[model samples]
Target: MMENKPDEPVDHLSQLPVLRLNLHELAREQRTEQGQLALRDLTRLLSALVAGHAAVQTGQVDWRVRGYTHAQPGGDVQPMIELKVSAVLPLLCQRCLQPALQRVQDKVLFRLVEQEPGLTQEELEAEDEALCVRVAVDIQAMVEDQMLLALPLVPMHEVCPQPIVVAGLEAQPIDLPARASPFAALASLKKGK
Candidate 1:
């Protein structure tokens, strides 16, 4: 692999050969890896990360990946991939309906498996931290997925960008005649009778 010059920008992570690296071998090699990619490169992946009022495609996200092969007490080898991501995204506050900055940082682990194991409902529900994927994994896609998972379900400011005022509450009361009692009509009828 040609090393990038310090002055030149790093190549997109998607173009890296690391995607095809055998997990076990990579873990053993302890590869020296470094790359920077724009958040906009993950257009489709970040499509749902923004609120209706904020545009988030223009931002920077840092990514680092490491592989590890762990030997269990029983001598079983566990091939795992670790990914770290840090990003600051612009999001709209749900309460104030204004643009706000959102910070997202996370580390995720992927356990490499030849094929997906069929787990019972209980097991599936119990498993949350480590995900298993096939050997020939798409690293870029995985990175995008991890970033999406880290996004806040609802992004909002601790103190709203602006005060929220209810339109109905703020509006002036309408002038109208007082409502007449139902008994008034009955008394009128009795008088006529």
Candidate 2:
């Protein structure tokens, strides 16, 4: 059974391994010209982590992150900030299309890089360079990506609880008592005459 634990606070980035991120804090950071978005906004981040990958199964995942900070040469100045996160998430049943409610846990380590707009588009797209970029360390997006990556592609159990059964019309047998036809009765009367 999947346990519903209380949401813990996330003052630092390291705490995300427990349960993604503090959802409330992530939501606060996502406000834009558009009003508050749905929880799906955060899920999009999760999708990025799983995109082009097979579905995940339900279970708990343990993740650890190190070297989250960027540093400049010969100095302690780091322009880019990085964060690592990990967790486990429950996957829905693919067959019955029901919530399998199974929890699969895994450990993932990913980095988030801060993009500098000053760099030209070509420089940003250069090969052998980091591809993932964010305006700021959007904790919500990071947490979402982690959660999505944990979902299973085919999330059904070994045996489906409910199986479809087809009922044929012939399966229902109907019985009726035999009765003499009215024409037979008329023929008998003519013969007696």
Best by TM-score: 1
lDDT of 1 by residue, 9-97 (tens): 86565474544445555556655343555676676645655544233545777778787776779998877667788778776678887
In order of appearance, the predictions have TM-scores of: 0.65, 0.34
Q: What is the lDDT of residue 106 in candidate 2?
A: 40
lDDT of 2 by residue, 82-102 (tens): 233444333456676544445
Off by over 4 Å in 1: 1-22, 49-58, 121-136, 171-193
Worst 10 residues of 1 by lDDT: 126-135
Q: In model 1, what is the error at residue 180, expressed in angstroms?
A: 27
- Provide the clashing-pair count of each candidate structure: 0, 21
Runs off by more than 4 Å, candidate 2: 1-65, 68-91, 111-135, 163-193
lDDT of 1 at 73: 90
In order, candidate lDDTs are 0.68, 0.43
RMSD vs true structure, all candidates: 8.6, 18.1
